[model samples]
Structure formats: C-alpha cells, structure tokens
Target chain A: MYGIDSSPIRKAFELARTIENPINLSIGQPHFPCPPNIIDAMAEAAREGKTAYTLTGGIPELKEAMARKFLSENGIKYATPDRILVTSGISSALFLLFNALVNPDDECLVISPYFLMYPSMLKFYGAKVLTVKESFGTDDLNSFRKKKIKLIIFSNPSNPTGKVLSKEQLTALANLAEETGAYLISDEIYELFDYDKKFYSIGKDYDKTITLTGFSKTYNMTGLRLATILAPEEVIKALTTLQQYTVVCAPSVTQWAGIEALKTDMSSYIQDYREKRDFVYESLKDFYPLEKSGGAFYYFLKVPIQDEEFTKLAITSKKLILVPGFIFCENKDHVRLSFATEWDNLKRGMTALQELSKELAN
Target chain B: MYGIDSSPIRKAFELARTIENPINLSIGQPHFPCPPNIIDAMAEAAREGKTAYTLTGGIPELKEAMARKFLSENGIKYATPDRILVTSGISSALFLLFNALVNPDDECLVISPYFLMYPSMLKFYGAKVLTVKESFGTDDLNSFRKKKIKLIIFSNPSNPTGKVLSKEQLTALANLAEETGAYLISDEIYELFDYDKKFYSIGKDYDKTITLTGFSKTYNMTGLRLATILAPEEVIKALTTLQQYTVVCAPSVTQWAGIEALKTDMSSYIQDYREKRDFVYESLKDFYPLEKSGGAFYYFLKVPIQDEEFTKLAITSKKLILVPGFIFCENKDHVRLSFATEWDNLKRGMTALQELSKELAN
Candidate 1:
C-alpha cells in the first residue's frame, strides 16, 4: 500500500488531465535537458558495470564531493562522511525524516501554503500536522514565532509562492527552533535559481536544522533521482538508520553523476533560468495581479478569476496549464506558474493567459 | 533532524564494520553485473534524453511489461495498471506499505529470524512489531495463524536463512490473512534466485497481498535502483500517496532499462548464479555445519562457537567476511554466508573460511 494523497502537485495535474486537453501546470518539475557533464558521467558509470549496491549511506567519493559543494556553495561545515545521507530524492528523505522523528500523534508545525506533501508525509506516520497561517504579504518572522513547533519544514526559496526567506529570517527561525528544541527541515533544492538575492539556509545557524538539497532542479537531473539530507551527527545517524528500510542509497550511477554536477560551472544554467524568470515576471505584469518572485522558477500570480475557474478557462480557451492555489491551501484567487519551460513556450502560455483574462473581464 | 536510527540492517553492518577487517555477511544484495543488455538499455536511455520525471506510478511501458511478466512467468493475473506503484527499490516499497497499512502502535506480524529490516521499518512508523519465532527446522504455520497482525511482512526464500516456504505453507498463511483482514506485504525480491524450487507468492491466494519485487537481485541491477510494489486497487491508491512523500517514482532511465531487462532472456544470468550457489554450497560442506539452502543465494551455516566470537576469530585468523547470525535474532550458533560473488572470489572466500574453522576447532 502506498500513500497517493501525498502528491497534490501530481494529483492536481491528474485531475486537470481528466478535462479535455488541459495545459497542466500543476507539477513543479523543470522542463530542460539535464546538464551534459552529469549525463556523460551517468552513461559512463552504467557502461562500466558500476551496478552493484553501494554503501547504504552513499559512495565515499561522491559524499566527499557533496561535502565540498555544500561548503563552497552554502558556507556550511560538516566533515565526517557520516553527516550526509544520500536519498532517492527529497520525497524519500521527507518520508524517512517523518518516520524517524514524529512519534505517532506527535505534532509538526508547517507554515500555511506549504508544499502539500508535508502534511501527507506527517499524516502517513500519524503525526499531528498543525498549519500556521501567514497572509500573502505577511512578514515570515512574526508568522513563524506564533507557535512552539516540534519540527518546521520550509523551503529557502519557498514553494508555491517563490518567496525566498532572508538570512536574518533564517537565523531567527533557527534560534526559535534551538530555543524550543524543535528541528528545522530547510529545503534548499532551488538554491541556485535565485535571480538577484542569494538564498540562505537555517542549517547555517543551527546544527539541529537538516538541510535537504539535490541536483534535480539545478542540473535538471530529476530522472537521475539523487538528493541528500545534511543534519547533525545524531540526526544523520537516525536518518541513515531509517533510510536502510526505504532506499538503501541513491542510485550509484546518479550519485556519480551528482559528483560531476556539483563540480561543474553552473552559472550559465542560472543565467538561462534568470532570463526565463525575468521574461515571465515582465510579461505577466499586465495580465495578472502578482507578487514579484524572489527566487526559484515560479511566479505566484493572483488571477482575476477564482484560481480553479481561471485554470479551467485557460485550459479550454488557450490550452494553457496553470496550478490553482487551492492545492497549496492558499487563497483561491492565485495560481502557481512555473517558468522552467522554454522561453518560447512561456511566451505562448503567457499570451493565452492574457487572452483568457480579457475574455473573463469582458 | 532526520530519523536515521530506524535502520537495523545498517546498524548491524555498522557494528560489523567496527570489527577490524570483519567479513560481512549481513547485506541482501546480489553480487554481479546487471545483465549487459540492461546496461546497454540504460546507456541508450541516457543517450536518448530519457532524463526527466516519469509518471509517478511509473512509465506506462514498464508497467505493461511487468504485467505481462507476471502473467507469463509467475502465472499471476492483474490488469489494473493503476494498482502498481513503482518505487526506488523494494525498501521504499516496504516503507510505503507500512505507512499505508499500519497506524501508530498498530500491530504488524513478521516471521522471526526473518529479514532484519522489517522490524525496523515497522518500528520506524511506530507500529508494534510482533515476531512469530520459527525454529530452523520446525513449521512456522501455527504461529502465523495466531497473531492479530494488521500487516504481515516476509521475504520469500527468506533473507538470512535462505528458506523457501512451500505452496501449502503460503496458501495456509494467505488464508489466515484473508480471514483476519490482514494485508500481507510479501517481498519476493529474491524470487529469481530460487534454485531448488519455484517461488510461491502469497498473492496467489489473497488479492489483498501486496507483492514487492525488483530487478536489483533478479538481474543484478541493484545500482540501477528499480523496484515496484504490486497491490489491489485500494492498497495501490494508499501506496501511491505514501510514495508521493517518499519517492515519486523509480529512476526513469533505470525504469526504461528495467523494462528491457524483464523482456530480455535472463536464463544465462540465472544459470551463472546457480553455478556460484552450488560451488559455495559444496565447498563449505566439509568445514562448517550448514542447512541446505532451499533457495536464494546464501548458505546459513551453524558454527560450534558463538556467532560474534566465531566471526571475530575468522576475521583475525583469515581475511574472510561472514555475517553473524545473531544480527538476524535467531540461533546464535549460526552465521549467514552470501554466495553471490564471482566464482573465483566465492571459492577463495570459502577456502579461507574453511581454514578458519579448522583453526577455531583446535
């Protein structure tokens, strides 16, 4: 038995799929070719017969490379190989974390409009999930301090809204977690996609914060299915133990490729992504009421019509797919638009949204 | 921040790793190249840019191949493509199944001296694990009937012991589960390694039984990381939800390769494994007391000394690696030896083990 409800992003797409030829924008995956170096490395590994089970945590060389990458990119320090746990992806890491930390009925706090999978992961282990609401423009600091939470999960460049938390905000949250003995699960998978401001992590402040990052978004290696969880020595031990029952390790070849991806120059890819982000932010300004996205490849645009109705109308009239905000438990007048697709595709999709907006206004 | 202690298998291995140059017999992995054809397929997929997120359950073509595979090879019938949830591996499948079936503190039954990971997986989710101890030579049927197990977990061609349950035994257990509303999670990962007899899955008698099988062991594609959980409609729905929080899908490039693996002729690889199994079996017969392994790629041997002391002595006197049996929670006099290595390596390891037995006897 598997937990299907944990995939609201996917389910949202699937539900829209049942409609006549909808432009599905519900899932949050990049639509680009994976980096050349990583693909080459994977092909090499596969051909060389590196197909046996790797170490349960991960390969040493890959782990060492990841350690270097984290230090260079995030300015965080973790020496022992035992501090990292390679995972299938962030999804499996989340499952392992929830299973290990949340004793049955233990309460976990999540900011409202969080990734839908967070609640499902908690619910799968029978952990109590509490939602702390934040207004669309509310300061994250005040919203986060309202409750004593056991574990708080947040994306550095927040999902659904593309709202990046500042370094000070991250440090404040980390302090609160330390004061209350709560753990912070900082998802920084989109660390490289910030257009202007740099992304910050709670892990930089407290050792209790577990940082989840991967090559999926940055290198467009989603199918390679590699991710890592960085935590304190004790948390790493516990998560490593839990991972043994799920994925023994990330794919060996993928981990090898991950090493290459981490080592390569990624500025060109970020430059390309920033171009798309800029194009979407500028193009959508006239069509939809929106908050400017700070980082990541998505725009949380406020549509003129109800989010669900607007998505439906766009799908029917323009073949444009956009995710309604209800999936993330946000107000119904908003939609999440991923700009990870090609700029041409984004142009076409944006034009369709404009046409749909005019028709609804008339 | 992550739950790592939930893995007893890694703990057992980690403990063994502490022993200076300990011979490890604790892993449940096949030691061989993934079939050359499968490797080629993976390389081809990578070359063709099959490097994006596949459908959540899995690629349609792979699921179709799997359906045909079960029908033609295992004589099982199923048509619901939606009922199969492809996983990163069988380990993730088990983790998902526990989440779907076991509520916190609810009971899940496991056969004792079984695969060590089951208890940890159940316990990680806070499920009360009830072990029904089975003496090596005695029937475990009566014990299976007595437990009020909401979920039952076992590996066919049992892990650690290499014992295969008879059809009658499986049918009786299936009938018991059917009567009790228990969902059986049968891990048939080792199904292809059965040498003495064909594997019997509880799925034959109980549609509610969730079957987990993978290419890791069968095709030596462990590093490729492909596995799937087959279940009835309701179980599949729940599992899909659980996997949404765990892993979205098995690696796509690997899944493409796996489809080819299932379609290609695998008799030669199995034939090679059979040879290795026999070579190791006969080589060690004169030195250590061993129960004839009915199936799977291991020789569960009984030693005169305590498992830990024998393991230590073997490591000190010889450069041999063998997994101690106490880790499996069974007869402390026993040890589990994997015969999955290359023929020459198996022979070399066996020779060293034989010399250690003689030295210990003196």
Candidate 2:
C-alpha cells in the first residue's frame, strides 16, 4: 500500500477539499502574483524560442548568476560551475541530495517540528528518519554523535517554526558534521524572508554542506517550479547524475525568468512580507503563546486545545483551513498559521480565529 | 564517490563536451525549435500571470486534455482525472513509478538495448535491474517467471534499436505481465515519430500497464519539461504523493501551453519526422546492416569494427560523435546513431561515418 496517504498533512489536505468556502492559510507559497518583470522575461524567453533542454546541470548564465549570488549574498564561495546544480525546485534538489548521501537502513538526522516531506520522503528511500524535537540546540547536535547519520537536514528560517538558525549555531552544526564525516543539508528556500536578522548560510563555511534554496519564495514563482542546490564537486556530481534520470533539468523558460528575478530589485517584496509578519504577530500575540519568527511566512502558535481537535473544530465550525502542528512533529498543543496571503485574507482568517478564541474561553 | 560518473553514457557526454565541432549524430532530441504556436501559448500564460503552483497532479484542464488524448490517441480509457498524472517528463514519471513499486533488492525487468536511464535509475533506487538481452519474444517472457519482478519497463519505438514492438508482440507481453502479476510500463514518447506501422500501446489491453509518454518528441517542447503518466488509481495515488515531495508539480505555464498543444493539429510535425526517418533509413541501409525501424528516430547498425574502437576512431580521426553499442548493452558489434537532426547535419555526420567505414574496411 502507498504509505504517504496516512500522513497527517496528507489527511488534512484530503479533508480540506470537502469543506466549502474554506479560508486556506495552509499553503506554503507567497500569496502575491509573480512580478510582471519576471513574467515578462519568461514570455520573452518563449518569444525568443528558448524552450529546449539546457545542459543537465543548468544553463551557463543561471549557474554563473547563482555562483555570484552565493558569494555576494549568502557569503559562500565556490571555485567553479561544477559546484552548482539548478534543480526543478528546492524539493527536487533535496530529493536528489538525500538519495546521493543516504542508504536504506541508515539513520538520517532531522529536527522536528519539521517540514512534512522530510520524514515521509526519507521513509520512501528506506532510511531511518531520526527526528530530534528541538531547535539548533547543541545537546540535540551532540546527542546524535554515536549514531551513524548519513546527513543532518534542517530548514533555516524554518518551515513551520519560522525559527532562523543563528550564525554561531549553523557553524557549530557544520563543525559537528565535518567532525563526524556526515553531510549537513540545509533548505534555505526562505533565506530571503528573514525579517529581523541577516541570514547566514552554513555552506559558506562548511565543505560537507549542501545548500538547497531557490527563486520560488523570493520571487513568488512557486508555480514556475525552479530552484538550485549548491554543494561540493563530489556531491554535485552525484546530484547531477540523479537529475539526468529524473526531471532532466529545470524548466528552461523559467530559468530565464529566474535570471530576470535575480536582477530585479525585490526589496519591496521582502519589505511587504516583513509588514505581514508584524501584523500577524500583533494580531495573535495576545490570543496564544507565540514566537515572533525572524523569517519565512509561518507562525507556530500553542493552542488551548489539542491541535487536531482544534483543526477539526475550526473546519467544521468556521471553515478555516489550517494544519495541525502534530503533522510537523509530536506536538499536539500547537497549530501552524501561514501569513503568506494578502492582508485582506489574513484579516478574515484571523477574525475567525478570534471568534474561536472567545468561544473556547466561554 | 558519485556512482553515476562511471556509466558509459555519462562518459560519452563528457567526452562530447571536449571535442571541437564534431559531426554530432549522438544527440537524442528533435533539431527543430518548438513550433511558434506552442511558444505563443506559453507566453500568453506568462502574460496572464499563470505562473503559480497547480494541484500536485496538475491543473484540471490539462488533466482533462491528457485523459482525452489517451482515450482518442492511445486507445486507453480512464474514467477520471485521478487516473492521469502530468509529470515533469517521462524520465521523472518513470523515476516516481519505480520508487513507488520497488525497494532495495527488488528485481525489475528491463530489455537490453534499452533507454540509458531505465537501468541506471533503477540502480539508484537500489532496485536490481535484470536486463533481458532479447527483443519482444514470448520465449523470452518466460525467462523472467523464476524471478519475481516488481515491473517490466521498456521503450516502444525502442531507443537504440529503433525496433517498434508489433501489436501481437505487445499484446503477448501485456498478457504475460497480467499472468505474472507484474506491472508493464511502456515509454511511448516516440509514438508520434513512427514512420510505417501504427504504434500500439500495451496500456490499451492491460489494466496494470503504466504508460509513460509525453509532448516532448511530438511537439518539440523538451525544454518545457512536461509529460504524463497514465496508470491505475492505486499507483496514481502513490505516484502523486511521490511527486508532491519531489518536484511539486509540472511547470504551471507550460501545462497551459500543453492544453493548447493538444488542441492543435500536429500532422505536419509527424510528416516531417517521417521523412527524416525515411532519409536516414535509405541512406544507411546499404552502408551497414541496419534495421528499418517503424518508429523513433534512431538507427542501431552493426558496424564493421569493435563498437568502442569504431567510436573512438571516428571521434579522434574524423571528429565525428557517436555512441558505441556496449553503452546500451554489452553488444560490441554495433553503434547507435540518432537521426533527430535536420537532413543537412545528418548528411554531414553520415558522410564522416561513411569515410570511417571505408577506412575500416581497407
């Protein structure tokens, strides 16, 4: 039988489709449409007849731009184009990286509250997903020392938690990985959304680090489905080969759009997300025990009732679409709320949450 | 450390990058640019801001068109959208299908002179690739009864061999698979390129048959990275879940373009490939013992010298690019040449190959 259907997130989405007129704050993509400039560039590519497969890894221009971005933006330096791979998305890049490094029966380290896909995908690969239920704590880092882990994977400016790992924390994890001869695979897809702090990529300092990030979140082109992975030559080679037998290459027309996206001044987009972050923080700070996350578009709030029960009640009573926190981890007392929507939709969803809070208080 | 670097096809491509202005008969894509109509459709999608993620399976319209296309063109009928999955390409569809059906150590049957990716990808998933060294013979069908195969995967309009499985042979394979409880996956990407015989898809006659085909060869949209997998519900659900954690969905704008592509009359494209196939067959029939293939755009010829030796001599002496036979299997007597290029380029490569043949005969 297909094992993924049993997962809580999958079940939640299945339940979601049955409800009528639901306010969906469950998706993890930017609510804004992709900018006109980026869209125009893609159209221009289509007009210019640029719709053919590039080299398996990437187009030369995109690769060069990505390399330059790593050095100037993420503060990571690479020697050549061989060190980078343009992927179908951050998701595809992660899939390939995990397959390259992990084997069946190998324990792959993951931190929970995590993205729903990590454990599910690792299970598909027949690897033992050893979930550590803490942030970047040194104890959690040290706890896995005796166990042979194929890789330690986490998202910075995290998916559910929106907890950005500190520079010192990332470096410590990097050092631990190097010391243990294990690879550190980081999903930095939300790197551009860090509001309070400047993001630090562990790949900047670590040789064994494989960084997965892309244009989707930063450029609001999730539908375009284009991203990149940066790693050393050995890992890049492995991922590239896997890619050839898989998606072959990123969408060429979208890759051209990505070049335009990188060139565009997206200060406005980041500034807008920062404002939404503040608005959501102010709206919910009193209703629940919550953290003002530094980056990404999600907030994990400890709810008054069991998370799944709360989700069921919200869906049945208010038609509010939200994911139970237990889907991300074993934490049954929380729910994840995404602020990646327009202010109007966010306000409507929050109003329903406010009513739910009052009804529960009664 | 990268396992794929050692594969001969990968090595051949690597060797290709170094040679200057080689007469290339090695590429496997159509030489023509994507038709202007399809390009216009994609640009229209971008202009309309359709560059966002669709449901993991695909957009509703595209799925409907695919279901209709399968019924009318391939003679396979599925009741609903759930039976069809739009993939990044046939390559990604096969990758997802194999991961769903197999685990490490499970045996999967494949034919020799197969597409390079089939066995290579199976190995990546830790599946045992049992490559049968025969064409579609019912006698060879019994060869796999002793082993419990997870699936039997092959390309119709075969890759290197260019040997299209006749309707009778396909029906026999379908029956054998059903009796043996093995899933049959047919790669019908080249169905449109068939010159003589009408293409027969095993999916038409069998319930468990998984069909992998796409718009790449038919429409010259390989760069768009769009394809489909038509299978039963149980497998469709599994593949859909795998897709969510891999590439989220096919590129959104391209899927719109796909809808347009399906609606357009593509008789002219087929007419062009038919002529090219005939030209290659007529040109090479006398020079070497070549099979006049009914479908696909490749010619597998038994060259006079050892395949690797011939390939090396041709590349170094004449600056001609070609793949040796042993790359697909251990058959050292042949070489695989693609006629997917325009007639002028094909003539140039064939001329070089002809001179080399004469020199070898001397």
Candidate 3:
C-alpha cells in the first residue's frame, strides 16, 4: 500500500468551511454554475434511459465530437474517435496515464510549479520524480536530459503560477522529449482560461504529445466529471484497458452532455476571468512582487514572510483563504490566489490580501 | 508499466455489438432503467447548481444516509459516516482498495470462480493471487493459512455463478480471516438481488472486513457511478487519500440521488429478477448440467464442449452472447449465463442455448 498526504489545497478547503463568510480565493474550480443547456442534456439522457454503463472507452458520439474539436481547434489531425479516450476528469486521465506509462524507478521530469497531482501521483507509482523549477529553457532541458526521463508532464496555462508557455518554450520541451525517448503529457484543462491568446498546444506540432482537455473548468461542470485524452493509438489502447478496471467509463449521462458542451461557447466567460486576472495583477503589483498571469485563475504572489504563516494570518485576521505555495513546488515564499470567484468577492479578496501583505511587511 | 489483456466479458460485449438482433445477455448491470424519483432527484441537484466537485470522501447527507442503511439493514453498526468512502462505482472501489492494500508480491486469496476483475486487477498491482477453486471449506482455509495470505476477497451473491453463501459459511470465512491476520473484502453489490434472502455481509461480525456496496445494481443507475465503502477508520482514511487522486469523488448529482435511493424501496424490482432466474433455470436444467442459482441473475452451466468454442457456436448459430467460464475460473467446460434480461428474450435465449447443447452433443 502506498501512503500519501492529503493535499494542502484540501486542507485549506476544510478550514474555509469552518470560518463564516470566508473570502475564499483558495478554490480550484470555477465559481460559475453549469450552463442550463448542458445540465438539461444530461437530464434528458437519463430520462431517455441512457443510464447504463457505456463502452469502456466512452460513447461514440462524445468521442467523435472530441476528435473533431482536437482536429479543428487544437490542430491535431490524427485524433480519431478510437484515439480519443473520454475519462471521468483530467484527474482520472492523469491517473490512467501514469499507471500506463510509469514503471518502478523510471525517471520522470515535471515542470515545477506543476499541478500537484503530477509529482505526488508519479511518486506513488514509484517513478523517480525530477522537478525542473520554473524554467523549460534549453539549459533546463539539457540538465534534465541526463536523467533519461521516461515521461515529461506539465499543465498548460499553468496551475499555481498561471504562466502559459510560449511556442518557443513548448518546442524546446517537445524536442527534448523526442531526443530522450520520453512521452510528453500536455494538460490543457485550463486552455479556455488563457487571457492573452498565448496558449499553444504542443500536440499540434508533436505527435508524441498526449493532449488532455476537459469540460470541467470551461463549463463549470466539475461535478459532472468529463475529460478527453488525445494520444497515440497504442497509448489510447493501453489506457482503455486500464480504464476498464479503474473508472469503468465516464458517467453515461455526462458523456451525452459532453456533445452539447462541445457546441457551447465560453468565450464571454473567459473574457470575464481575463478582466479579473488584470484587476488582481494591477492591484497587487505595487504591494507585492507578482507577474501578470497569462492564463488560468491564479496569481502566485511572493510573500514577505513564509507562505504558510502568511496564509494563516490571512485566515485568522481577515477570514480570507489562500493556498500556500510550498505545496505546488519547492518555494516557501509564495502563495496562490484564485480570481475565479464573483466580481464583488474578487474585489473583497484582493483588499484582504493587500492588507495582509502590508501587515507582514511591518 | 503493467500490461493486461482486455477482459473476456468485454470481448463478448464488443462482439455482440457487431451482430444484428442479438440475444444480448453478456451485460453485468441491471436491465431496468433508473426509477423516475431517483432521476428527478439527480436532475434537481444539477438544476440547483450542485454540479461542482463535492468533497473527495463524499457529501455529508449521502454519507449519513449510507451509514444509516448499513446499520439498520446490514447490521454494520460501526459504519459511521466518517468510515464511509463514496466512490465512482464498485469497480473503482475495488481499484482503490487493491492499490491501497496490495504491495508487490503480497499473497492475496481470491474465492473462485470470482469476479473477473479480482485476479486481473490484483496481478496488475503485483499481488501473488491465489485462487481457491469452488470451495471455502476447512481444508481450503488450512491450505491458505500456510501461504500467509494478506487479503481475502469475494463478491456476495457471486457474479457468474449467482451462488449466495449462507451465514455459517460467511462466519467461517470471517473466523479464518481473524485467525490468519488477513483482511477480508466483501463485495456486496448484488446483496439486493438475493432472491432467497440468504445474503450474509461479513462486515456485520468482522471489523476487518471492507464492505463495498453501490446503487448501480439496485437503482439501475450504473452510469451514474456511485458506490460506498465501509471499513476500519484507518483503512477508510488511506482509501480516502488514494481516492482524491484516482476518482476525486463520485458524480455530484449522483451522490444526491444516492440519498434518495436509500429512502426508496427496491424489492419489487428484485422480485422480477427472481422470476427471471427461475424461468431460465427451469428451461435449461434438463438440457444442460447446472445448479439453480440462489440469488443474483446468473447460472453457471456445465457445457459439453470447450467454453469458448461453445460460446462462439451459440453466437454464430443463434445470435446468443455468453461469457466463457474460463475467464471466471479454472474451468474450461462451463459458461456463465446472465438471466438479467426481458422475459420474452429470456425464453428465446434458453431455447437457443438448449438447441446449441443438443447440436454440440451430436
């Protein structure tokens, strides 16, 4: 049995539940309710008696829709329905991919400030996880290449830092993977959250890249639990077999709703988050050292004191919730603040964070 | 990376899809569609914007309801809400349990003929799986004790055979587990399908037993993907931590429906399967050597020829789909026949099966 600690994000969530009227900037999901049409689609599916176990991979219609989305949207031409494996969520996809690829003591490279699941899950699978902190430049790649990394993974429109990789950076990583005989996993769950139109999928240029995108964040249906994986045919085959014993299949009604999700546009919603990101960045840049996040909903602010201690003070004094940065990477001087809440709540959270930073300075 | 072949049950499903007007009996889920009340409950949950992720363990109301059900119905008084871990399905519950308990080369005893996933999944997790064929007698226990088995697992109202173990038999197994220091996993997904009312849950008397049950079999909501685990608090804690990465949580809307499911009675639906089981048993007993199933909706028949070859003949000649028994156990001369289909289709399937037996004998 492999033992793992409960994630610090979950601890923050539990703590926030105890405090009344918390300004919860620690949430990982979108604040918006799921669109009415998508909800209706799933309800209709259930009413129509489409509530039995689906094929082990997924329903054909959803898989076909995902294939089309990958080809026209992500510019991946090889993704057919057979090559697309619909999973419960991106989390489940990561679980399946890791179980299928990671061998005991296999060297795996993760771009740091990565999704917390990457390092934790890889280590559980007995992979020797090597972190390349905050850089995928040529030098970082050269240093990592010596480890003979079997797998390289990172979230695009990154999680804690919200730093979307440039095309040049993605190309460097892709080349490194190809030269070292490693598979690249591009977690693009936050692709729709890109603020500056700087998002680039490595799968478009490299066939070795496995592209993971999902409807949870984009449609605010995190509970519905649907995601799609575009990978090589052999990898898809292996994952499909693994999924049979694991997820069995994604929810049947949710698979039907995914067809409608592909048709629904979330550009307006993304625009709102872009404005929120700008507001948080501009307000805090003078008070604390922070970068204008290119995508996702988080701002990793460098704190004056230790990240955990600062978060504790924020919660105790201001009734604010923030995730300490030590969980996401090796850094202890940063904290992640999500702007994915309501506009009024976002404003209140920003004010609380500003006050906390000033207090820490004193 | 672990390599496993696709299950024979899945192979039969795939083959059935290719044929027209096939007498499909290869399914492992309930034949009934979800009840209207349960469907409405889930729809209401989704409409009320409860579509975001719930806590990894589960929502409070559903867990409490499951705890109550365990106490009143199964006599498991220790199954408090904190000890219940909601999962995507029983398959996922098995996945999490095996991953949490089975270290490399651990000796695990599986009661056979078993659920196909037991042996296959244990092997994938690097367990040295030991199968006790068709008996759990004193002799079997004595032999198994010598191997130092770390885990013992089986489904109550056994799949592929539909043999419900008596209370005495369950007590003996629990005693063996206690004496040998092996933890027992009782997969009671088919407990509600106990037509003879002879189902015995080991958790009622054994604190070391992990009881897995779900709404998928009872409510005909397999696609909704909700199951629960009752175990020792420490085991629940470890599984809960593992679930955070694997399943995350059960579907949000489904978890709400599960609360409604516990309130609803399912005896009428179970009675229908009881009639189906009797109908198939009486129709084919004279033609093939078989034992009458006490619960669940399956009959394991001794075929006159190879199980796989017999199944192929039935499919080609009569459009009947059946799983070969070799997948379930070491037996090669038997096949599993699921009677969980419509009355009219069941009649046609029995006639086809009888004719195939006659042809094979000739």
DockQ of each: 0.56, 0.64, 0.74
The list of candidate 2 runs beyond 4 A from truth reads: A6-21, A130-142, A145-147, B1-20, B103-107, B125-147
Higher-lDDT candidate among 2 and 3? 3
* Candidate whose DockQ is highest: 3
By lDDT, highest first, what's the ranking?
3, 2, 1
lDDT of 1 by residue, B218-272 (tens): 8878877789887898777766655655677789899999888887776776787
Of 1 and 3, the candidate ranking higher by lDDT: 3
Worst 10 residues of 1 chain A by lDDT: A134-143
Residue lDDT tens for model 2, A96-211: 87777767798887878898788877877788988776455676677777777788888888889888888877877777787677788889999989998767888878855888
**Model 1 misplaced regions, further than 4 Å:** A1-8, A15-27, A77-82, A103-112, A123-147, A205-208, B1-27, B104-109, B124-147, B286-288, B356-362
What DockQ score does model 3 reach against the true complex? 0.74
lDDT of 3 by residue, B8-69 (tens): 88888888889998998888777788898888998999999999989999999999999899
In the predicted model 2, the residue pairs found to clash are A223-B52, A223-B53
| CAPRI-style quality class for the chain A–B interface of candidate 1 | medium
Q: Comparing 1 and 2 by DockQ, which wins?
A: 2
Error of 1 at B261 (Å): 1.4
| Candidate 2 interface RMS | 2.1
Which regions of candidate 3 fall more than 4 Å away from where they truly are?
A: A1-3
* Candidate 3, lDDT over the whole model: 0.88
